[model samples]
Target: MALATVGGCGSAEPSQQTETDDSAVVLPIIPAGTKADSILVDKSDRTLILYKGDEEIARYGNIRFGDTPEGHKRFEGDERTPEGRYTINGRNPGSRYHLSLRISYPNAADRAYAEARGKSPGGDIFIHGQPNGREGAPLASDWTDGCIALSNAEIQQIWETVPDGTEIYILP
Candidate 1:
């Protein structure tokens, strides 16, 4: 099966703002900020990767997907992971996990599908870390509420690398 990677072909592009110094100025800190292109989740492989454009900047292993990885999410308590394109909607500093990045699920298609069935497309999908101080759990088992699971260090790396509103695509 092909990896459910996100985005089309493109080079890694960091939105940089170059500045000039006036009297041999010394830099204090360098910022590695870039516009996040996409996040790839391979449930079969249990890996979550962050990409800037097409370059893989950070890869988090020991990740987990929905309990049932058969198809896209259908309804609440389906225990199925969502497939297709999505985006990073928001961030949660306070979460059951150490931290989380919200995924923009229920896109127009999802909404329409749910609406057609007269059901609420269950929400609150996230790319989050393991339970508080238990970041090691994700490495042990596939435990999550339908959201992609990562470790604390991995989540922090993602939190710092990708900005909010970045496009994320999850495939089957």
Candidate 2:
């Protein structure tokens, strides 16, 4: 049997006494709440605005969209972000990107359309941070699988402010 050593400087040795470390680090927490009336995604400006009953509360810009930013997403693998009124259903902290807020895509109409076309409805759409490669890149282009993209810090703020079931509308 072969053993690996730390720093690659010596042979590894197994300890006769089994020692287990039990320590945990606690992080400060933020409460969940919906303080906005609706969230608007302006495809033309590539910005997201949070409103409270017609009054603007906060705005997040430099958002990225799908590869093809044409009409609303009509089918699977269209690479087009959906544009319509929907609700934020849930949040995912273990997203491929950073944290994310799940958008209720493929509504009833979307499902029916995909079913009529005999195709599967694409899923896993979200408003998330940049991917690992593009994390440090400046927001210059619209390139995504089919979801809205934000900066890592912006996403963390959104995750804290926007609770599940918040209404959102994506416009063309």
Candidate 3:
């Protein structure tokens, strides 16, 4: 499938650097006070990667998604994580989850597609941590309504490193 890309939101584009030896994964050297400008979510791999300019800053694996986790989300309650480009539009410290970074899903194309079918394109998608009152290892299965999930510590790191308006590309 063709990868979907959107115009930059006035931020630097992200690029991945690989070692000459294909088997080795070279992590980028990020200076102190640096922040991620973009994020990439690979649904098939269940991973979320953070990038700064052309360098990968961090990569979180074992990410979880909605119960029905494949494919682009089309309507409310589909339980499918959306596939495409979006932005981290907001954050919620008081969210029921440990911490949350909002994703700007249901873009123009999403709305049009759902409207044509007379269904509501769901909103309120986010990348968040475990439930606020829960304490332990992360859940073992796909459980969100349609949001991406990470561990509390992982989300805390992401919350501090990623700013609002960071571009995110969710892929299948």
> Scored by Cα lDDT, where does model 2 land?
0.68
User: Residue 123 lDDT in model 1?
Assistant: 70
Candidate 3 per-residue lDDT over residues 118-155, each given as its tens digit: 99988878897776556456777998988998777677
- Each prediction's Cα lDDT score? 0.64, 0.68, 0.77
lDDT of 2 by residue, 95-121 (tens): 455566777887999999999989966
Point out where model 2 deviates above 4 Å.
Answer: 1-34, 133-135
Best by lDDT: 3
- The stretch of ten residues in a row with the least summed lDDT in candidate 3 is 1-10
| CA RMSD, predictions in order | 12.8, 13.3, 11.3
Rank the candidate models, highest TM-score first. Answer: 3, 2, 1
Q: Over 4 Å off in model 3, which ranges?
A: 1-31
Candidate 1 lDDT tens digits, 78-153: 7677888888877766555556677877788888898899987777788866555441234456656478875555
TM-score attained by model 2: 0.76
How many Å off is the CA of 162 in candidate 1? 0.9
Q: Any runs in candidate 1 off by more than 4 Å, and if so which?
A: 1-31, 133-139
For each candidate in turn, the TM-score is 0.75, 0.76, 0.82
